[model samples]
Target: MFRLVGSSVQLDIQDPKPEFHDLFWVINRENNVVQYDNKRKNMMYYSDYGGRVEFNEETYSLTLKNLQKTDSGLYEVRASGDEVRVVAEYRLSVLDPEEAPVLTHQLSRDTCNITLTCRGHDLSINSSCYKETCEEKEVTSPGGVILSLSVSGSTIICNHSNPVSWKTDVLEMKELERLCADEGEGEDKVN
Candidate 1:
C-alpha cells in the first residue's frame, strides 16, 4: 500500500484466530513495533511508535499515525506461543504528494497544427490537436509517477499522479482556435 507522508494507515489482520497467544507487529522482521499480550489483555508500543500507534484489542489490528518516508517497509504480524506463527504481512510505501502538471502549447499558422506538452515530476507527455480532434500520449517513471494527456470535446486535460495524490491542468480548445484565428489575421501583414 502507498501512503502520503504524514498520513495515517490501518493495518488489519484478517481472520485472526482467538487461539493465538501474544501478537507482535514487527518491521522488516527486525524492529519490534508493538506487542499485544492476549493473556494480559494489554498492548505495548515500542520505540518511537509510542503514542503514535493504536492497537485494536478486539480486531487485533494496528493503526500507525504520522507516517514518514523512513517508515516504508515490510510489516509483519506474528503470533508468539509454543510455536511462532506468522499471521499477516503488509508492504507499505510512503511518498510525497505529486505536483501539478505544467502545460505548454505551440501553434503554427500555416497548418494550424498544435502541440501541447504536459510535464510532471520526471515525466512528460505531448498531445496534438487539430480542429476538433486530439491525440494523447502518456508516460510513467520508475518512481510510479504518471503523466497523461486526454481530450474531451473542446477540453484538453493533463494529469499527473502517484498512488497517494493527483494533480491536473486543463485547456480549452476554443482558446486555441481564437489564437490561431488572430494569427491568421496577421499573416498578410507579415508577408
Candidate 2:
C-alpha cells in the first residue's frame, strides 16, 4: 500500500493474477472504521482519514488524496482471508511542486542551404540527427547540434539518446523559391 499525505495524490495499481480481481480498502486509524473500498475503484475527498489506507492484494497499491493532520495511523489488508494479511503504517507529509525542462531552437540561413539546431537544458551526451526515412544517429556531445536539410521541403529531426529528448523542424520550399528569384534578378541585371 502507498501512503498519500497531501493534495493531488494518485495511485497506480498492478494486478498479478489474471483470474482473481484485486481489492483495496482504507481504515481510519483513530476510529478503527472502514473508510474506503478498493474493489469498487472509487475516490474519497478530504475526510478524517487522509493517508490511512491499505490494499487487500499484494499485486495492487492504493493512493489517497487531500490528506489532513488527523490522517495518521496503521492500515491493514487481507489478500485471501484469515490466512494472508498485509499491514502498513504511514504518516502524512506535505510537499511542493516540481520543475519542468526547457526547449530552444536556432535557425541559420546562407546562400546554398539552411541549418536548424535544437538544444535541451542539462541533457546527456550521445545525440543524433535524422530525417523522416533515416535511422537515429548519436550526437557526440550534450551541447547544441545542427541538422542540415535542402532548401526544399523536407523534415529534419534531432534526438538525444540518454536523456531521451527529440526535436523536429521542416525546411520550407519558399526559401528555394526566393533563392531562384534572386538568381533570376541578378541575371536580368547583368543582361
Candidate 3:
C-alpha cells in the first residue's frame, strides 16, 4: 500500500464537487497543478518517477502512478471563490525499502574468530568476533542499520531500518560451524 516508494498512490475525496466555482487542486503549497499533472494542457512533464499523474475530472481525485521520494507531500482541495474553504486534505508518504546487509565472511581459526563485512545503501560495516556468540560479537552500526541479538543465543540477526521501512537478515551460527570446523575440531564450536 502506502509503504512502498515506487508504488502508485491515490488521493481521493468523495463528493469533492470540483464542478463548483473557484474549486481546484492544490499541490504542496501552490495553486498550480502543472507540476504534478502533466496532461493538463497536452504534452508531458517530469512524471515524477517515470510515471504519470492523473486527475479524474469526474471524481475529483488525484493519482500518481510509479511514485517516488519527491512525491511525498501535502495535497488539498479548496474553493477560493467567495469564501475560501479547504474542503479536503491529504498527505502522501513514499518510503523506500531498507537495504539488506550481506554477512560476507566467516573465517575459522583459533579462538573461533570470524570476520564479516556488510555493504548496502551506500554503507559498509566491518565486524569481528570470537566463538560466534552474540555476547562476544563486535559489530559497527552503519547508517540506518541495527545489529541485535542475545548473549544466550547463537543466532545473529542484523536489521536495517528507518522510521517507515525496514529489512532484516539472520545468520545461524550452527550452519557456519561446519565451515570453521576443519581445524580445531572441537574448539568452542557454535552448538
Give per-model TM-scores.
Answer: 0.92, 0.28, 0.58
lDDT of 1 by residue, 1-191 (tens): 99999999999985547466889999999998998889899888898775889888988888999999988999999987888878889999999989999988898658677889998877888778776677888888988888999888788889999999999999998988886787777886889
Please give the TM-score that candidate 1 achieves against the real structure. 0.92
- The TM-score, computed over Cα atoms with residue i paired to residue i, of candidate 2 is 0.28
lDDT of 2: 0.37
**Cα lDDT for residue 66, candidate 3:** 76
Stretches off by above 4 angstroms in model 1 are: 189-191
RMSD of 1: 1.7
Error of 3 at 117 (Å): 3.3
lDDT of 2 by residue, 1-191 (tens): 22233553333323344232223334443343232334665434333444454333334555555654344444443233334333433333332221232222222232333223334334422222222222223344432332322222243334332222234444334443455466567767979
Q: How accurate is candidate 1 locally (lDDT)?
A: 0.87
Ranking by lDDT: 1, 3, 2
